[model samples]
Target chain A: MMEFLQQRLTDLELFGWDEYINYWFFLAMMALFAFELIVMAFKKAVTWNLIGDSITNFITLFAYRFIGGLIYILFYLTAFFWVYENFSITQLPLTWMSLLGCILLADVIYYWEHRFMHVCGLGWATHTVHHSSPHFNISVAYRFGPLDGFFPFFFHLPLIMLGFHPFMVFLAEALVQLYQTALHTQMVKKLPRPIEYIMNTPSHHRVHHATNSKYIDKNYAGIFIIWDRMFGTFAEEDEKVKFGVYPRINSVNPFTVFFHGFTKLGKQLWEAPSWSYRFQLLIRPPIWAWEQEQKRKREAAAAEAKASP
Target chain B: MNFFVSALSTILLGLVVGFALSLQKAEPPTEFEKYSSANMDFATMSEVGYAMAAFGRESTADYFELKDYQEYVQLAQNDHAKALSASDSPQVAASEAQASKAEAPTMQLAQVEHPAKPKAKPSLKDWPKSVIGIQRSTELINVEKVWQEFASNSALSDQLDSYTVSVFAIYSDFNSDYSRATISIGYDKPSMKGEQQLIPKGKIETLLKPSNYGNNALLNAWQDIDYSKAVKAVVERRDYTQNSELTSLFVIYQ
Candidate 1:
């Protein structure tokens, strides 16, 4: 009986806690608590919904990272094996050319790749899972599947080609990931105007995740919000709006998630009139499809008027 | 008015002396007390006595101006040494080298156990003069190789840079005898200097990292080892680099 209990206890997830005394986890938790306390100290109602949402989000994030991290490791191992079988990695030059180029290129590629994930057909397949949830928090950040490996290969292909060792790329990627971890919170609501102009913030992110008609397909920035503002895709987050995609993915089932955007793309492609129409169905921004569907409704109404007259 | 002020001064002086004597004759604190007054060190001990006369137990203040972490480490070692002496151990604190008495030197000595020199200090002083110092260096680790063996080990790499930038101590025995110990870690930063304490009057060109050992286990992503192994291993690696006679190999720890 004792052994069974011990096994169950051992199976309990540590949230990567088996290492240090769970400093980062405690820090996140204390931050939430401190925020709640500030609210209570002012005698404001401690919103139970926020507390529930944070817990649900944290658990979701943990589950995804735990499972997805294992698969990511497996794929990375294969890549490592492939590298080892190829050549001696020693005496490789870690030059300024590769370092600066990889950083700027990675950032630029991340902007486009992420923007495509939010908009295009094949890219939307995996990314729609992130937008499915009505709530937004850090957990929503990691609610991704094991298939994220394929994209990074393309994004970081330059690292391998430039004789930059796989390790530098790996380290750089980890630092960027560690940064993205904090970006998914409701905390730090607004940044200073300079960083707001250049960096992604909760305000800009709220607009991205907002399901409101006017707010859809906007504010896409992986690191630099300037990309969105410059490209005319930016929308200032309005408080009246709520989170999640329009006609939400409502199910908790993973299958429904995996197929949502792909199904939408397929249906639109089938009904499209021309080759360009079909191409736009797969390649255009999600809002462009919404506009096309609305245009079809207007044309049908106009044809009805002419026939009746 | 003058006569009254003189009387008041005499009474105040008496009160102060009485207060001082009470403090000196006070009994040892109870088990619940935070520390023994004598263990508080000489300078703090005097202040504690003054606090006792002035405000008693409420006035608890302590300070130590440690120039380096070695002092705390030395205190722990010295305590152990004192304990070992009580058990009739062969070693005596007096015989150890004052300069080479820290943990790193002792660790280097521990590697080679010649029973004859059980209490004798290790002669790190006579080792290679070509590559001996500490500061910083950069090394690009083969994370792919390390990650293969221990991919699940997420402590270092989950944060995500494959190569660790680090620093190490370099020592060259003879022209061909070189070794390095990784001392620090940064990101993509190589070739650091000016962290060592001692600077000779001449142009002693020691760049915490010497061009030796080519980022062996010292700067390797697997930053695991005691100071002794690090010192000795770097020295062994340095020996090969000194063959160039002009340039020595170095390693960085991340």
Candidate 2:
């Protein structure tokens, strides 16, 4: 019986690491959906619009998981593993304390990475899709862009080289992700004050998703709220938060949802007056690109007006 | 054999369960079209209000905090009333009446000969004596339209009926290569603060570039000058890429 079980475990190895992680992640996703349905039965918050948004999100997530396998091999194995094997300061035993320390370190790295994603133009192009949905629900949690998965792993590479096993670092990240999945709903309002103060609750996450002036570019944390508080990106939920991006995307097309920001960036890159301006368009804060493009259009129109007569 | 059967059964069970979960539809698919940018008409909607909240930091005026959509509508009405009253002031009314009379000759000439070239430049002989600060030159562009265009993206125009719109231009004093111009449109009565320095320098040429129509460019046909007040529009020209210093101003009051 033991030999037979061992053989079955080997069969699972045919799918590789991403599938192994995804198999369990898939089950967790299903459980979250089930819980969401149960909450919907009693709460009127679950609308048809949310469901459709969720379906599109599910499709995106499924495709990401499938393609992410290749990304994992190409970028993760070649680059991350090389760093971990060659430059690890020292090996820490896979003990409980080491796991806790790794989670704490990984959470801090995530905070910075998440903040950069919101603040930078190129980063926003990849990350904004997650916040594109106006509706905040369980399905919104699944709205992952393919590009998002490729770059964020670099943030955690430090942890792998600091003597934490790469798998353990990934485990911490997955745990953070699972916690974040629960933060996507409006069903749970403010938790207890201490819990709310210390942890990244739904309230804090809602502020993160909001387009309100006070809320924009605030509250970027993964598992803990301390990082935001320490870093000054923390914003309290003062005003009624409006969800989704500003100058919001107006199309229901999945392609538009996925690629509108990239298209805007691409156009600016082509029309930019100089290489420096083009580089600025790519790497500057998202608002800087938007303002520059607007200035360019205004100048062009003004030129046309002058040329007419 | 028992372990093999158990493993196979677990795999089969997970697949069936996962498929079943996937089949769970989200009631009626969510309506996301309303959120699409195509359906959202920002042009027609008020954008200046949002602009004021978002970009009004540089302005010396007070920022009105709007709590909700209702407050926005209420404030918009209040601002419109303020503007109407400001325009109705005796001085403005007198200037406007005089402006209407002054605008007739140019309109008639535009219709008969050319719309672009009408009337000789206003006589700068009465130009105020220059003291020290940036020089000034005032010109009346025309008197045909009075409208406001929001300068920034994502402004709440409806609630922002009372905000200012600035227009900038460039002028060469026949010395430097590049220069800038600024024209401001607002409910505050226009003032020619620097009207004294309308003295035209050596071979002055107003370079009408494509960038002149930008938010800082004036679209109004005329400007009404109140000489006592700090001129609402600060028009300046500067060296290429040099910090734009307000050197010359052309304010035409109607």
Candidate 3:
């Protein structure tokens, strides 16, 4: 059993290690909820904001983790058996430089995947579920769309083959995630200016969820803020940014939350005027669709008024 | 008042949880905890020492394909020590004299060839030699295939008229001395029937190849096994020559 497990641990890389940390982290998350329920007693409404969101989101995330881990183990095992035995794909140099390169490249991909979830149409579909509840707190941070499971992390096969020990990579990814989880709470509002500049913050994440113009679509970082800043995706939360999207999907059904993006993707593609519009509907910014529809409505109103007058 | 009560209740619950976790800290498997990596710091013997204590029903996976059926042949408990000694037990020497030169009981020969083959034991000066010989290939039986032929012809045991017993896959080189592994078989007892039985280590036959195994490329996907299953700890042990082929061994352990 130890032999079997050692191979798995070595194979799980940092991912397994992150799970190691998460066991304790999961305990910590539960303890916070305990404090909220037993000490503050949920009646203290503000605590609910964090505790409520966190508990609900965490339960869902936990379910996904259980299911996802089970499924991925099958895939990872099949892949492991074939590749570890037959191939010498440890082609990537296992030096610190290579490790650094793999991790940074992964972060780069993650930053964009995250950014795309915020832009409207796509945002309304996938990212809005997170902002759906009328709550913002540590637990809210735990709430993620089930669709988020098909993340870039699973797609990182080439990176593993490139020389990253899947184990170490998993650890790095989990640490990055754990770090992100720490930022979800309203408890910590600000840090030193230098830290704020480089890291994603509750302040920045608050902005990303904000309906406020200045704040929307800003401050997307997993472990580093430089990705967002470099890509001009950074927005600072100044005014109290309203959470949740306008003309919200408004459904509490988690099923809706899961498929809202997919539904919107289909809707935008179908209702689009031209092939390019359709293509853009699928790929372009959310604002483009809104602008085009607004123009069409104004022209139709004018035509009606002129004929009647 | 409600807030205070909640806090007190939670603190109590936490204490209970801590107690439960602490209680679980005691158990035999704690040393084996964290299957991903056993605490090798406490390991003094070769890595195989870890395998002997391998436990828990969860560990059937580590066991190989269940060639499930097992049969035990009990010799007199007294012969156990004799059976364990190098094959030159007085019983064996007497048995060999009654047997053929080609089939001589060379169970204690120090040479690599069949001791019964009209050859003298090779001098230690000729050690490090690679000789191709067969290991015991089947399950253990008190009546060996070679011995069965002799005993039946001699009509030694009255039961031999209908006696059909299994042959243990052990190769005794009347010539060269060989190394051996010890094995233990568990005896499950029912409340009402079938007395508990003692099973000896079934001989696992190894094929001798001229090529010896190297330090680096020994076996693929082989895990460290528990080396201390010695029900009758044979002092014999075996290692490899320079270029041993991977499939050169076929074995059955009792």
Candidate 4:
């Protein structure tokens, strides 16, 4: 069965079927999203803000794709090829087994990379754009930040060094991404217990996007929810889930949504008292940085009052 | 300011302690270390012998004579004696050296004549009309005969004058027997600038004939390779000059 599947994949690749799969799948999803809008309109849920937000999501997607393409062509591919050619311990043959292993490992790496984006201040500065949307829908999946494409290089480069071909790693990454894209919806409430436990369903991903205190920094899985369970980041959908980021940017304007994270970070850095504190703001968690900023403001106010007295 | 000074002082103190610790005497070599050192010496000697043979010079037997062997033994004994003397055991060192000499049998050195000059590099003019180079691991297979067979087709041979025809067969793994392979043929206009500047004539997805793998060791290893695999092989173009005749070709596998 494995050999048969491998041969089928090879045939599809030979016929260039895999190249056009993404475009076709995207068109199908867009159709589904349009149907969803019509359904929401019937239910009196469609608003101008929702429409603007979806448009902004697409704009961010285009920007991400443009920047991501430049980075991939100029840096990512070059680095991946160099590391694979020079440092790879062994070249794994193209087979069903190896491809499966690459996908599994790539998914695990995605979990950690996703977690990093939520925890690290710099990472949150970029990732916050995706989570900034108040509404969860298919269009929300398309929302991306400027450096979203760039950070994956750090996580996936090791796959190339581990002997999986760069192309194989790329395919694995795309599969993981595509799987997650389908989960950015509220239509599917839950699934069978086995699948819900094993896979990253819409319910699990909804919790991931939730900004509620209980759901903050939870469900960082890509294709498998097992990673979150194993890593102690897993949370079940028990309560009402709130979407969007904390201290929201409050704008559907594409430029505002795209640059807000970096602008906010820059403001914090400028407000920081010292170079050491500024550096700490970059590496520390977003919550810690926020707390530190509040502390700094209090200290500054107290010092000003004392000087005046 | 206080923090900076303390940090600097701590770093300086750490450096001094590290340097002092590094200057301390090393422990005696372990049995594994001695074995590894002896193995390395043997490997070095073997490499020298291989290098000489590869360059068409004398073999290892002709290179190391009885006199040279005796001289090496004498040098080793002298070094051992110096070490023993440093330990204030000169009498024991002398007795050991005497015993070593007694164990050595008297042998005559064989007179051998050395080559007067090094061999010259092969002229590019001697290069074949079509060159097929296969690189796999440390082995490089240059099959002029295979190239001749390929050039037998008038259509392919015609491109030799204006375009550099490159046939690249890429394998998924080093062990090609069980791996997948993909073959591509690229035609590039010969130019001096670089591969990037070359005007691509065309490219064709092709397959190598089974007969091509008959004699070549590298290709034979790839006999069972699956040609259905998807791979993109890089094409490398190189220029060869002999007198006024300039022959340009693409080195498919480097």
Q: Pick the candidate with the highest lDDT.
A: 4
Scored against the true structure, residue B221 in model 4 reaches a CA lDDT of 33
Q: What are the clash counts of all predictions, listed in order?
A: 32, 36, 37, 0
lDDT of 2: 0.53
What lDDT tens digits, residue by residue, belong to model 3 across residues B1-254? 65345335534543443333233222232111222222223232112222322332223212211111000011122233443574543454333323322231111111111111111222223222122222232332332453334223321222222211111122322122223222221111122122222332355333322222222222320222223322222211232111111212223244
Error of 3 at B27 (Å): 36
Model 3 lDDT at residue B214: 25
Model 2 CAPRI rating: incorrect
What DockQ does every candidate get? Answer: 0.01, 0.00, 0.03, 0.01
The TM-score obtained for chain B by all candidates, in the order given, is: 0.23, 0.21, 0.19, 0.19
Candidate 4 segments whose C-alpha is farther than 4 A from its true place: A5-18, A300-309, B1-254
Better of 1 and 2 by TM-score: 2
TM-score of 3: 0.51
Who is ahead in lDDT, 2 or 4?
Answer: 4
Model 2: per-residue lDDT, tens digit, A195-283?
98899999999999999989988888889998788666789997898999877775556777767667867877887889999888667
The candidate scoring highest on TM-score is 4
Model 1 chain B is weakest, by summed lDDT over 10 consecutive residues, at B108-117
Candidates sorted on lDDT, descending? 4, 2, 1, 3
Model 3 alpha-carbon miss at residue B79, Å: 30
Docking class of 1: incorrect
Q: List the lowest-lDDT window of 10 residues for candidate 3 chain B.
A: B65-74
Tens-digit lDDT string for candidate 1 (A80-174): 43553364232123332333333444554565557667766556655766776676666566556334444666555444443434544554454
Runs of candidate 2 with Cα error greater than 4 angstroms are: A1-29, A35-48, A297-309, B1-254
